[model samples]
Target: MTKSNNSATLNLQYGGGFRMSSVIPVIRKFNRFYTNVLGLLDQHLLETDFSLSEARVLFEIGHTDRCTAKMLIDKLRLDAGYLSRILKRFEEQDLIYRIQSDEDRRLYYLRLTDRGRDALAKLDARSDDQIRLMIGHLPEQAQRNIAKNMAAIENALSDDPQIRQEVRIRCDLKPGDVGSLIHLHGWIYAKECGYNHVFESYVCQTFVDFFKHYSPDKDRFWFAEAGDEIVGAIAIVGHPDRRAQLRWFIVHPEYRGLGLGKRLLQESLQYSKEKGFRRVFLETTEDQKTAIAMYERAGFRKIAEHENHLWGVHHIEQTYELQLP
Candidate 1:
């Protein structure tokens, strides 16, 4: 079946289960509210002669490298005929020009003229001014929260990999880092491992215990962040006899497969070695095959396993240890 038909059939089958009757209205309301807030319903955008779609096309042409009609169509999901007309108008207005690609004679590259750049700049300034006017009265924290939430929405809806690549890794623990990490552990484990609130309580207690003897010289935390959000984290806890334990290593699900988990683990191991810890070990369940493989590749050998009835599940708890040279 075609994609649209398949989607329709799936929606019919699962729509009730997902409570679409309630969810659909909420989404539609948000769409209407956002469009109105941005004055997208107006014939002209930002009081300019350019329509909303025309302004977007102009902006993308200016910013995108080696822009083309095909790229615009794919990025914006615009109709070919509509986009062609817009491009034709832009050419007539001397706002844009096209050049044939040397490698492909039939393929043409789009570029914005000086006038087009000026138009886009005006649109950008207007957009910024509109947003500033909307949120400028809010507290500084509220403004920051707005931007962070918007980034989150974009990350959830966008197919662009660039959003995931903007993660920053840091070793400093801030005021709310532990609480956020605990929340992440609870949410991620429940979603991925069917763990219950008991598991979350266990994580909380672990942090409580870790803090009892937390030494700045011995313990280290590495957090991978995007904007004001923590997407991944790892920590190494010092123990007696020059031994250390790697704990609380995790990456947000959406931020995985970007080598973030590997980076966090490496940071912990390197910190362990730098602290002159002779042995580094970690405890994890056998169900975590991906993490287990990563541990093995990092020269850790599984030395122990036991059946455990905890976290609302039956699982084999395993210990892996690495001896540093």
Candidate 2:
């Protein structure tokens, strides 16, 4: 109906998609922090005669020995020409060795030399120390809070079987990301259960508080990623009373109806069993019937039913428990 713009047809066929400008600035900020503020680039340039790109290659090889050249290309998504140039530079520097795999002569695998290993250690220590310093600036409680929020953010952007190119799970959560997760959760719950305005700040804050106080070594969080995007998550926290608490179980709306929630619950349950937990427990509202059914399917039995006047007058509460093997 309307006249076209300067570009070609704006149809979805050609993969013309919407772009978020906010992400670019954040990436640029981190780039500056690593190169200019942290002096990471300067450190590598001064200590070794290697450029930043070469240093990254060496670090990757040092951390994961015998990685194929194709592996790096796929993982890092680097341009073949650029990667080849960096590999050649590292090869010239004697920091890495490349060999044709015995089984596949066409496949070139890379290994870091002793010098490269030493360099990676230096980089790891410097990065860890810097992160520790930053965390140390906050109080212990605040550090834990940051770590939990960071973990949520990481879970949201994870790139595993659950999803790809999304949020990262199994990482430290940031300050604002949990709120974002809560907001995102609201949309998912609304879409899935036809319950609008159900997930709020109180629920998000409650789960965030639990994660911040809980010890991860005693517990673990499972998340699903679709193309590096965190579309689902499940947290299992072990209490001193020998009980495992399931909290903040959620999945993004785009990934719903795929049985991912069930898969995550199964994984958490198996993990709980492996960790020697005798039982797992969770709380939900009457409004979330599907989730309640999912819990039941996961072998969770209703342990308690009550009314909650604390949050709202119409709130009906139910607690479910699963006995672990």
Candidate 3:
């Protein structure tokens, strides 16, 4: 069969670049596979009378506080006319009711009737059963990995601030923490700065050196984790003469804007002060403008900088120092 004009236009738009064209097929394949896996192509959802969209509407009405049609439209990106018809059907079936607002006569709030709640509970049970059956044969670790990957996908695509996961900061170093931090540095720097594998080697070497003289009383490491994943990290490596050096300071790009970097920085600086360090300093490259701005704001002043041909690139290496009061 011949391709349609719309398909031809899409090919023209995306086919020019290898990177763009490659991603399109992968995403489309995932969309098709997921729809089949979830039985989303069925006329009704999970053997229920409600269509997928209608079931989602029921779920929101049952769970949301003071739900409204406008809220549904915004949350689901559903067309207004389509949602209106769904709500009307629910009303006719005695599954939902609306109450006019006391202060605003024109505004009405949607609430699930008793029958609606029962229907929603049934849908929820079936969904849980379906998911359990799908993943029941997998090992426990495999199940957890699937969950983590799903969360990562959601966090990557979601623009809603509320969807971002909560990150917790801890100073305890686990068995694989060092390796994970090194991986973060290597992967993030390579992607963000086009750094070669030499940069990863440098990071690995630093950890090796840090472990040689590892002093638990004087040194500390902070890891910002979301669920089981380490998203940011920093460390205070104690030195002679009451000095300390901040090292391995990195944040994953997906978790950067959530104040995690600032939290990690403050934790390290506070620990340095508690350990009676007179000065703390950190080294970074000139290409890290955002991190440099954060350092300056944290009372660190640029003390030294020089052109260095390290990390497979020729760039200005900078040192910023903060003095303890």
**Which model scores highest in lDDT?**
1
Worst 10 residues of 2 by lDDT: 5-14
Alpha-carbon shift of residue 322 in model 3 (angstroms): 1.1
Candidates in order: C-alpha RMSD to true structure: 6.8, 11.0, 5.8
Query: For candidate 1, lDDT tens digit of each residue in 12-78?
Result: 7567756656567657767887887667434336378788889889989999988999999999999
Task: List model 3 lDDT by residue over 1-325, tens digit each.
Answer: 2448657756766677557666777689678878887574343363678888898999999999989999999999999999999999999999999999998999999999999999999988877777787899999999999999888888888877766757778888899999999899898988888888998999899989889999899999998887799988999999999999999999988887888888889889999999999999999999999999999998999999999776777889899999998
lDDT of each: 0.90, 0.70, 0.88
Full ranking by lDDT: 1, 3, 2
lDDT of 2 by residue, 1-325 (tens): 3435312333432344444553565456556754674474356445656565665666778766579777777767788999998888777877788888899888878988787677778777766776776578788887877666665655456564443233444534546555556776776655554444534656667776776776767767766654334577887888876789997788776566667788788878887888888989999988888889899888899999898655423577899999877
Evaluation by TM-score, superior candidate among 1 and 3: 1
Cα TM-score per model: 0.85, 0.48, 0.82
Deviation from native of the Cα of residue 213 in model 1, angstroms: 2.7
